[model samples]
Target: MDRIANIHTLTKRLIVMTAISLLVFSVIFGISYFFNGRLMMTWLGFVCGIIGGFVSIQQRIKNVSDEELTLLTNSWFQILLVPIFGGVFSLVLYCIFLAGIISGNMFPNFYIPKPSGSVPDANFMIELFTKTYPLTGQDFAKFLFWSFVAGFSERFVPQIVNNVADKSSEKVNPSDR
Candidate 1:
């Protein structure tokens, strides 16, 4: 009974901490979006991916055994790695989009604007934000959706990579016809 109560307490702590972490990252992303718009897509993708990871973990927690739940929630090392994994997968997805492997009403290209001063002026900062932001409103939503999907489904990017590899191999070693 005591152990079960402790597990429940730990689980609640995990949920609260993850929520706080998400809020913190959202604030960071908002602040950095314009200042570092050069990597805006990457940043957005990472944040979305982190959200996906958190959501996925939460869903799994519901269906898991108490032992598994305790292990998953208590393992800070594993929890910390979630964001890194999310970022990496999101980055790979961004690269794929940039490479024209995935195409839609999306802008895969970006240009960094030059600042007038060491600290960019407002117009220059606006220019920087406008130039580097690759998507319009709807398209950005799409990117966020896909990036979140990628993070939620661990197999998503790996499947894409495998598919690309298969295609590359076929191209390199064409069968005699």
Candidate 2:
């Protein structure tokens, strides 16, 4: 009877996790479609979301209760937030690289062309934000790679860091020390 109850509980958790994963992937796909209007971005977001969801569940599966699973699945919003923040961070870095404000081997060669006559302003920035660039296969691959990194690391990296910090801060016995 106990084994049966455990199986039932495990099944429920699996179903909930699957639903949350799909929800996360759909939201990502919708946002990417709205912004870029490219199938590649949609696919990239879907793959990233799945990878992120799997990583999250795998990390928590061993000790998670049904209630905790619900909470964790609901927190999948971080999957979206991380990638958006990462995209903004990448944009800022690209801008800084282009402006000659920071020059070194650290920055890649961003291929954005200089404006012919007018200086960039708020309007230009707005246009840049709304406009979808023509991405090559290599560029799309790089974008997807970064998206995966952002999504996968959103929760995983922080958890690992916290675990390491917590372990290090634990006091050792006088004899052990």
Candidate 3:
């Protein structure tokens, strides 16, 4: 069994996340402000980070409850987070795609559908994507960036939350055991 998976091993994960988030947030915000003279990007990142924390908790619930691990390790719940994570990442990437294209002052070749569904008359979803996000150089770059960020955030969030949960739990010292 992975020691890190143990609830007692959470401190290190939290520490690492806190340090990395702080550093990354500061550097990105600084660069953005220097160029745009505004705190929008920084604020966005902070908000995303905080939201990411909650998302991480959700993932942790899934991780801790994984059948293979749960049977061997005592936990509080059971869930499959892969679909949830996929949905979240997809949305994140979509938003990033939109934001990046807009920022680059370029219209995407693809057309996203509105909630009404009447706005887009396409019969297929893939066709919709084809119409919405242009597979251009800038679009591809933005897509990659979004994928990387979303994936990193998703994968790490659970680890952070698990660590937090573990740290909060009462520890059983070896002498006591």
Candidate 4:
């Protein structure tokens, strides 16, 4: 009976901590967004961070088995499918059916001018990252900063909250009894 009660108490505490963490996380991300440029990809990173944190909390409480973690990690392969499909799209564009739509709009411009019928320009490879749109220099920096903060908060906050809860319960429950 005591063990069950403790389990229930822990669950409740985790729930409350998760909610409060989410609120704080939102406030921090919102402040960043307010101060930064209004780019859609940067905004998406914040949303993804909160969602991933929520998922991690749920999985932690459920005491997900190793098999479950493997499955969850494997699910990231779905993201790789985008690049696979993109390559096919690029092929179609090269075939002239898409007429440079995929290459021009989606990917970095890789126009490497040949040096008098020699190899393509050496700077072409370097320019790929230096010239990406939508995720230009500033947006990439802000995205990295916010992602670091979110990852740190998600990994550490719950442990800290749970430790505090455990200590408080031990001190108060013993006194009350």
Q: Which structure among the candidates has the greatest TM-score?
A: 1
TM-score against truth, every candidate: 0.71, 0.40, 0.32, 0.29
Question: Per-residue alpha-carbon lDDT of model 1 for 21-78, expressed as tens digits?
Answer: 7787777777876665444566678777777776666566557676766666567766
lDDT of each: 0.69, 0.49, 0.45, 0.41
lDDT of each residue in 18-130, candidate 4, tens digit only: 47655865776677557653333323344444444443444463474555444433453432232233233222222221123223332322222234435546565334322
Model 1 spans with C-alpha error above 4 angstroms? 1-14, 30-39, 65-67, 105-130
Model 2: CA > 4 A from native: 1-55, 58-60, 63-118, 132-135, 155-177
3 against 4, candidate with superior TM-score: 3
Full-model lDDT, candidate 3:
0.45
Q: Total backbone clashes of model 4?
A: 0
Question: Tens-digit lDDT track for model 2 on 1-177?
Answer: 343454455456556655765686578668767876734333444456445544544555557665554544445453235345434444433344345444444323334434434788776654454443324555555545544544455554344347645665664443454
| RMSD list, candidates in order | 6.1, 10.3, 18.5, 21.8
Q: Candidate 4: minimum summed lDDT over ten consecutive residues — where? A: 93-102
Candidate with best lDDT: 1
